[model samples]
Target: MEPWPFDTITPEEIDALTDEEKQGLDAAVAAYIGECLRRRGVDPAPPTSTPA
Candidate 1:
């Protein structure tokens, strides 16, 4: 969690994003979290089991 932490963002907030913005946000957040987890020697969380 750097620029935008998960606890600070909500599903409703993401739903407010346009499709293109949403995709970019998703990538940025995923990468940020992945780095954080790696630094902690932990695995990143798996993706959603089903599409929203």
Candidate 2:
């Protein structure tokens, strides 16, 4: 799956996502980046984010 460009995202686009949709999107993004790092033999700590 192709990742969406961060710069292309807007608040309206994010607001349109349902809570479930948001969670799924977040998980997919994490998986994609994690796999990329794994393929390169790099293991990093999981991410931490503050609540908005």
Candidate 3:
């Protein structure tokens, strides 16, 4: 995925993003957080569901 398009964004700027842009931003952030977790030896996967 391409890097975030802007260095920084204001709330208004985020609010103005097109739907596709918002999806891209969300993906970029998720990817970045996953990488950080991996670097710290943490599993990035979602926790397994427990039986009720």
- Residue-by-residue lDDT tens digits, candidate 3, 1-52: 7766676776689889988888788778878988999999998986366222
For candidate 2, write residues 1-47 as lDDT tens digits: 77666888876898899988988888888899999999999996777
TM-score for each model: 0.59, 0.70, 0.65
Expressed as tens digits, the lDDT of each residue in 1-52 for candidate 1 is 4555468778789889898897787788788989999999998779876234
The lDDT values for all models are 0.80, 0.82, 0.79
Alpha-carbon error at 10 in model 2, in Å?
2.0
- Report the Cα lDDT for residue 33, model 3: 87
For model 1, what is the alpha-carbon lDDT of residue 41? 100
Using lDDT as the yardstick, the better of models 2 and 3 is 2
Residue 29 alpha-carbon offset, candidate 1, angstroms = 0.3
Q: Over 4 Å off in model 3, which ranges?
A: 1-8, 45-52
> Model 2, which residues run further than 4 Å from truth?
1-5, 49-52
lDDT order, best first, reads: 2, 1, 3
Against the true structure, candidate 3 reaches a TM-score of 0.65
Q: Residue 1 deviation, candidate 2, in Å?
A: 28
Q: What are the clashing pairs of model 2?
A: none
